[model samples]
Target: MSRLDARFQIDYPGFRFDVACTVPLEGTTAVFGSSGSGKTTLLRCIAGLTRASSGFLQFDEAVWQDDASGIFLPVDRRRVGVVFQEARLFPHLTVTQNLKYGMKRSAPSPRRIEFDHVSALLQLEPLFQRRVSHLSGGEQQRVAMGRALLTNPQLLLMDEPLASLDRQRKKEIIPFLQRLNQEFRIPVLYVSHDLHEILQLANHMVLLKEGRVVATGPIQDVFARLDLPELVESNVVGAILETRIAEHEPHFGLTRVEFLGQSLFLPQQALPPGAPLRVQILSRDVSLAVGAPLATSSVLNALEATIAEVSESPGDPYAVEVKLDVGCPLLAMITRKSFHQLRLRPGQKVHASFKAVALN
Candidate 1:
């Protein structure tokens, strides 16, 4: 069953976020757009903190809003849990105490979440007695996540939850977030403008432009159809793939992931087989050759594909986007110099390859 049925419109000074969309009742749905693009505002509306001018909001068949009947639930009354950009844990409260607040509120909840499950999923056992103020930025965020889970909500909303942290902190928290999604089977509505995070975390994308939804679909199809890459940001160029951890190789310090029939040796942390994973491969990092080359190079992940289409890229070094068919389309950004070097043209057979570290 679909997890969410929602729509809303909000007016701000010279800005309007009139969004109408449907999200899966499972997995993470990303509300992705640039800053001041109404990502946060949309999340607020869902939480019942920001009232919509007129719309409908439902969670798993429960009606939170229906303008026709003027049905509106207060923020506190709605069975929704929200974790904001800032880890707003009570400074005076210990981690355990802060977590307890949400659990106690859910005591009367008809569908309450177990404390042990929440603690285990978020790795909160080690910091149970530590004061909120004493924890690092990442640890505090972990605690905040635990608090939200303890609420036992039907849906989860996250508004740029990792925005306030540095790169290291973001890395530390993402794994936990993914674990929460799988462990609890909670539907998440995540809002963000960071493409890397979006590619890594979300399975569904709701592309917003000027406060209106421009496209929505499985991320791959949406990207293939999206012509305006400028709407996003620089360094926001890549594609996502579903990969599974394969058996390990002791000789080489690399982890293999089954990409299709081929096993891609990626510079990822090793894991056991059958573990499902997602990987991001950057477009710029991809290099193209006219045919499979017998070269002496460490670069791996070579795929045979035909150039289906090409487009002009904006930069000092002129570039073009090449479409490759490894079942799905793969994007490669090649310089004008190299394009002329290979005498590359459309409908030409070519090989695309890149380094393992470039996978990120």
Candidate 2:
């Protein structure tokens, strides 16, 4: 698999931005951080929009920037498609014309995306003849994405492309973004401070903290790490499990997914059996028991797990975080009072339970 290697350092009067990491060139890799964490700054360094004081960047075998060799590719020469917070479309031009402008500037020989295909992918045919000025916020963003895809870029850089939209608009645009990754197989560097967005869209993550790299790896691994104080303090720490639909229990109005021989139940899904599914299990939603509870309980999932680790929850001193291994890693947040009562320790056997309704 190809990867993007980048190292950059920039200094200003009161702030400095420094980052070094290599992320795989597949699916979506989210550049995640709070404000002033250099999320966008790092993205600009990769996009060639902001030149770093000292930097070296390479995409797969191609070196886009290297200070040692004095090689720096300009924005246009890099062949990267960028989508910003705003659509930045030409109000005077119709949507079709705007999309064609991107197609015209694309590299001709290796052109992989055509205008019609992009139009269909983004469902932009309805607004093609309409001026971008009259489109809704969500519709305008769809046009912006179509234009970017039409450029036939080797990589796509998005800086909070959904930040300006309302909840409904964000919902409307997320499916299109997922399609871009699934169907087109375009490597995307999506910059966003929203954890919800990262969880929904990113396969890998580059976590930043005050202009420094805090963590970078597959989303599941990164989230499971206990050393990252930044994540622990965020109070949203959890585990992401990749599973496949096993079967649907129509009578119970539930769907079953299997992961490493363990099963989890969720609300009924319209997707067919054998379809891929990614489920987010927050630590707060899980409970640990010394032994398997009776089947008479209302909770649906209760898997036998072995205690892996225990640590204080950074956000709440009174609480403790427990890591468990049930075919795969799982996390549970419980009060310190219960921690002492159970005397939980590593390598001990336990059962992890959570209500099926807790999963979405």
Candidate 3:
């Protein structure tokens, strides 16, 4: 059962935003698209501030609104937390006071979470006495996160929460969000147009275009899919592969990520074997070859796989999806004309060539 379910149709001036999707109870679902794509609008509708002229909104098995008969819950009663692009803390308040504001706001009584848990998760102990205006951009974001989580909401919505911060600040705050998701099991809808953000944190993706939802699913399967070119190569479509560090070759400063226990080397920081790590392999980085090459200068991440399918549209790149017996999959996009030249077909064994730079 999903912890979040929502659908809405809203109009603002000449633009209309229509969205519908259910996200899993765990991990984050990145609502992605261009600035004008209405991703944020859809998020606002779910938050109950930008009421859709009509539709249904449900969270954690409770009906927030249903249109068959008129029913709408005010934002205050929705039990949903929101974190904005800017940390909108009260300037007069200290970090402790700001967080207490939400904790004190919970109805009936504050419940399910403690201020200490959120503080520890976000590393907030050091800033407890600091006024909101005195903190760094990243610290402010963390404080904002603590404020929201302390409320014990059924769902959390973040609308480009990192957009206002510089790259260094954004990088610092990412690990905290990942921890918040896992430690609390909070289902979050993170709206963003940034490719790097989506690749690192999202387990699922919901793509919006001109106010309508064009695609939604697990990041791995969705990245393996075709036709969302607007997203695939452009926004860095890919998945987070979890692997054990097989070994570290000290001389090369290289580490290997194992898929089904086979080691493939890539130059990376040293990590102990049996320690878990993640890798993001992009689609554009992948090139296909018919079989194992006898000799080549390319340090390709060679593996044996049967072509599960080959899709070559007129004038479109000859994109192929290969399935390895190792239980991991790779997606590659090549020129369609190259497909004809190579005489590639389904069920054929092929080498999926990729470079270290391609591994994000």
Candidate 4:
């Protein structure tokens, strides 16, 4: 199996970075953390742009670095393509020229991505003749991505490529990123602090904190951890569920999705039946009940669940996290007042319900 594995130990005057993780060389892998958390440092190390004094880095069967043996591959020697926060296109060149500049760097081997293929993949055909300065932020980023893909790289390193874009622009470019990930099947190491981006694009995740690896695994498994929201210092607490469209209820503007051994009703989606989708449900959106709530309630999902674990919520002195085993683990955030009133405890049975709209 193809994989990117690395273990690094870097020391500074007052800080030290100790990290080790492995990510599959397929689909996108997100390196997530807040600023000053060494996310970029880790990306640089993987790309061979920054050397780890004591480390081992390997891609599939090729070793990029091994300190014990005094081996380290330089950036140019590694078949890696990097995209930064900003689209560093040449101001004087047209989009076509910039893309060609990237293609020129290719070592002339049989290429998997061609100019026409990338142009179509990124929808860049019409923007080819336009100067880089004239395009929108989203357009420029798309071109940057197209340029990177033109290289036919073994690995792609993107460091917050959407950070410079506004909300609208980020929204505009996401589908293109998704398309590229699916079309090229390139191994990508994407770095970002934005949980939204990771939830949408990442299949595997590596969570970092203060220059250390906190967790690394499938995105759904990592996100479902009861302590993750506190560890990342963000309220992006949620569960990622991979489900299929089982049926549509047009009269009610609802869609039925099946997962594990149960089904859920969500806002109507235009997708055909049997289409796979990944849904995210925030913990705050879920409410717990000692018994089944009335059918008259607006909640559409009320599944029977057993308490897996209960823990105090950090930063919120009045709230607690309740992990529920409803076929799959689901997290619910409840106030201390409610917890005490309901007499909730571990190993107890309860009902987990949330509105259909909460299934995003």
Candidate 5:
């Protein structure tokens, strides 16, 4: 396993931050939290742009930082690439030139990423001859990502890469980001405050609060933690499912997905059989029933589940969050009245139903 282990101690006038965690160094590992949570600071620390007063960081066999040994690699000495909120492309250069600039920085080696692969992965072929000023916000960002990839770094750091884009622009760029994870076998450290974006791209997560690492694990398991709502923003609390395309019902405009011995029908997707998919189910979209849902119901999915925990919803006195183990943990939000009426308690068997549209 390619793993990243880190411990940090940073101090300022009034604040002291202490954190430690180990995460797999593959796929997208999101650094998630709200404002002032030190998400960016952690990213900078990993990139060697910011030094933690007392820290240790290791990726597989390479030691990036170890304060105890007085070893601290500077940014230039590290094989890391960073993409900020802005594209930061050179306005006077053509897209080709900008990408070439990134390639120029890397030491010559057989492992260096080829320009063609980066171009195709990011869909930058058409923009190669265009000036940086001529591309749309999304296009520019795609170019920026391509440039980063061409650096052939061991790890890529993205600090809210989509923050500057509008909703439509974000939508336009998500596929490319997905490709970066699914198609290219590159390790990424994605920093973002937007839970929606994290849900869409991250496989694992590191949650921070006041510069401290509160939780770190597979995205699904981390989201299932009963203490999450109390530790971070509660509204984003939800579940993730790793599923495969089972079949498609073209006539009904829906597709079937199999997850943990259960099947769910979602809005039609053209993916072929066995294509892997990751879907998010918001806690608010889930409801609990004492028995299996009837066929007449509009809800497309319901599965046997057992209550794992019951906790108060952050800032919502009238409702409580229920954690259910449906193969994987599924979170549900229900009114206090319903909680009492159902007599819900841990280990109770019930059915969890959710509309397929709730799967994002």
Candidate 6:
């Protein structure tokens, strides 16, 4: 299992950034934090775009930077592809020319990412002859991504690539970004403050706060902790479930996904059966009952779960966070009133219920 080992210490007049973590070099790992939390700074350090005052960074077996040994690889020598918030395309060049420019700068004996394959992967064929200045925000971003892919990079660095786009444009580019990792097998360091984007794309996460590492691990494990106030404060605390499409019910306009011997119904998805899917159920969306729920209820999901842990919700005297084990771990946020009413405790059995639509 290849991994990225990083340790950085940077100082400015009024800010200090000190972070260290070992991130797996597989799938997408999100560098998540609020604005000014040093998410972009960490990314730039990895990309060799910004030098760390004193640091060490190693990708797998390659030591890109080691100040102790006076070894530091510059940006171009790193074979990293960077996509910024803006497309930053050449106004005078057509999309093909811009894409080819990246291809021409490929690293020696690089993993081959063919120009046609990149064009088709990013759906850039139609706009090949069109000037980048004439393209829409989403189209331009897609072209930018295609150009980056053609560079045959060892790793892809995206710094809020969708931040400048409107909601619809973000939606337009997300699927392509999702496919980039799956198809190219390129490790990605995705930096963003958007929890929704992180939920949708990241398998592993490195959480930052005040320029320091707050949490780091598989998304499921990190979110399951329920002890991080940053997440609780954001009011988006949840569990991430990795499931597979079991079947589709066209008559009911629903798709069934299976995980841990349990099934959940979601609004119809286009992916074929057996495809892997990641589902997020927010803590606030889950409800608990002392016994098995009745079939007469309107709520769509009711799973038998055991109370694994319970703790006071940070900054909320009236709320409590409950950890449940329904084959897979789940987090539920309930009022302190309900906590007393239910007599909840670790090792107690309970049923977790939530509406099917809540997952949407």
Clashes of each: 1, 0, 1, 0, 0, 0
Badly placed stretches (over 4 Å) of model 5 are: 357-360
For model 6, residues 247-352, the per-residue Cα lDDT tens digits are 9999999999887888888888888999988877878899999876887888777789999998888778999989999887788989999999989999999999
lDDT of 2 by residue, 51-135 (tens): 9999999999999999989999999889789998898999888888998887888788564887777788899999978878899
Q: Per-residue lDDT for 194-312 in model 4, tens only? A: 98898888999999999899989988778779878867887655577778999999999989988776788888888899987777778888899897678788777877899999989
Model 1: per-residue Cα lDDT over 112-134, one tens digit each: 67888888878889998887788
Each candidate: RMSD: 2.7, 1.7, 3.0, 2.1, 1.9, 1.7
Model 6 regions more than 4 Å off: 356-360
- Candidate 3 segments whose C-alpha is farther than 4 A from its true place: 107-111, 231-240, 270-272, 293-300, 312-329, 335-338, 356-360
Worst 10 residues of 3 by lDDT: 317-326
lDDT of 2: 0.86
In candidate 4, which residue ranges exceed 4 Å CA deviation? 108-111, 356-360
**Candidate 3 residues 158-203, lDDT tens each?**
9999999999888888888877888888788899999788777788
Superposed Cα deviation of residue 66, candidate 1 (Å): 2.2
In Å, residue 112's CA in model 2 sits off its true spot by 0.9
TM-score of each: 0.89, 0.96, 0.88, 0.93, 0.94, 0.96
Question: Model 5, poorest ten-residue lDDT window?
Answer: 351-360
Candidate 4: count of backbone clashes, pairs at least 3 residues apart or interchain = 0
Residue lDDT tens for model 5, 1-360:
989888888997787878888889899999999988888888888888889999999988999899999999999888888898899999988999998886897877677688898898888899988888989999999999989888888899999999999999999898889888776688999999998898888999999998889899999888899788887767555578888889999999889999887898888886798998777777888888887677797777888999999888867999998989998888889899999999999999998887644233
